[model samples]
Target: MVYIIIHLHGRYFIMKQGLFHCEIGMADKLAMVVFSGTVDRLMPVGIIASGAVAMGLDVEVFLTFWGLNSFRKESLTSNTKMSRDYEDMAPMMMQLMKTKNVPSWFDTLKKAKEIGNVRIHACAMTYDLMNMKKEDLADIVDDVMAVGEFVDIAKDAKFTLFI
Candidate 1:
């Protein structure tokens, strides 16, 4: 009983061989292109990842631009900015979350990984352009990959969002 999984053009195709040889389509994956660094925006990424994994779907996150920056070791704690539209309310929101004992966005994302498979990939070009090494990134990040590779991986995903 040999099984192979193939993802193409935003669809998953499973191939079964030997005793059975056939292709089966499935949409059990989530792919996200995280490009923002704002706290509000990043929070949703964590929630979505957690929910997707809870539903038994694999999650692949491509962190590029500001998103990659936020994943840096230093920024993980220091980056407190929120979306510009809601900039003025950041302080209040932060305080409210703290008062309510809500975990930080990064912590939420880490929690999701603990429950299921979650691969976080940094954009190779951004990683190099920013002059950062793998050590500078958080442990949650799986690796650095080019845009093409990320796109290829995302193509087979059932839901791909740019957050």
Candidate 2:
């Protein structure tokens, strides 16, 4: 006896007698465009990247504008402000996070990088515009890259998010 099985998308099939199995494909790469400098927006970027890493997915983060600003060595530790639209909730949110023992976004990203494949790229335009050097940014930043390069890297990603 012989059996054949084929799966599509998320569906799977199993056949007896002659063992055959198929499974759906999952996105192996996660591309993130981090454009915001605020803690509120940055937190999710880290959390999501961490989640992706946990699921065995590669993560690429392209930091531009305010996002690159937030990763500066001088700003990472001192930045506590949320988005302007949520300014009023900053204090409360901070308090809640502290109460819950939530780690900083940078810490989360670092942990993800340590355990999995996570690449952090700083925008070349932002680097030039701000007159910043590689030394001026956090150690987590893998390299400084042009938007075109980053776009090429992200174009093949199975999932992409802008934050």
Candidate 3:
């Protein structure tokens, strides 16, 4: 016997015995969250990654710009420097944190990766722009990739978000 299954949005309908049956919405099956912000900026991404993993979704995180620096294998403890173009300066915040002896965003990201299935990738173009090699990146990163590579990875994803 064959069961006819129809999916609308997050709802699933199964047709049987001339009757329609529905199943509750399941969590996302796959997700690709691209992170272009600083490591500290990745806190929310980390939470999302962990939450997705908890919900049994495959999660991939693409790290670019200052975000790449958060995953260095050996030195996962660097603070991100705000770009010169940033209108609202965060240096004062950083300074205050330093005064308070708070760990940098890098450390938090490392902890998150350690506790979750977060796959981190550094952008090759940004690597070249900054004259940084893959070896220069933090240890938590899973790979260094080109934009094409990342796009290819994200191609079959069921959900994609840029943050």
Candidate 4:
């Protein structure tokens, strides 16, 4: 009789523990993408980021090289030489973008900011040499950071991409 009681008690305890140990996928995933290039290369990333945000994914973007310039307020706002590689045509493209109301880089940025859980990080080394203050960047950018810090964040990401 004592053995029977003890066995029933043990079974109850096991079932109670199983209720608490049942799995639930409440944790969201992480995505880290490295970008370094012209708007042509980086714009597609913005589009993708917006889509990911729509799907409820957390996104962190690391912007370097000419891609970094895309986050600058002036670069987003005015018709300026965009990429050094396209010295001759950059200005023209910028103006054409402005006239079309097709949403300049600035507009795309604003949409991403409004709809997404997106964090834009500037490269710290580039920021210092470029004399760019945090305030000089677009309103959408979350912070400036080094590659090491970014990597640390990316370590547990569900997906990491380079663009």
Write model 4 residue lDDT over 94-114, tens digit each, in one string.
668669765654566568768
lDDT, residue 50, model 2: 91
Ranking by lDDT: 1, 2, 4, 3
- Over the full model, what C-alpha lDDT does candidate 1 score relative to the true structure? 0.90
By TM-score, highest first, what's the ranking? 1, 2, 4, 3
Per-residue lDDT over 40-118 for candidate 3, one digit per residue giving the tens place of the 0 to 100 score:
4555666666666766665667777656644545445444545456526677767777799865555554555566456
Q: Give the lowest summed-lDDT range of ten residues in model 4.
A: 1-10
lDDT of all predictions, in order shown?
0.90, 0.88, 0.63, 0.66
* 1 against 4, candidate with superior lDDT: 1
Write the residue-wise lDDT of candidate 1 on 1-163 in tens digits: 6687776643556667733344565547899999999999999999999999899888999999999999999999888899999999999999998899988899999999999788999999999999999999999999999999999988988879999
For model 2, the superposed segments whose C-alpha errors exceed 4 Å read 1-27
Best candidate (score: lDDT): 1
Regions more than 4 Å wrong, model 3: 1-35, 70-76, 80-112
Model 3 Cα shift for residue 93 (angstroms): 7.4
The 10-residue segment of model 2 with minimum total lDDT is 3-12
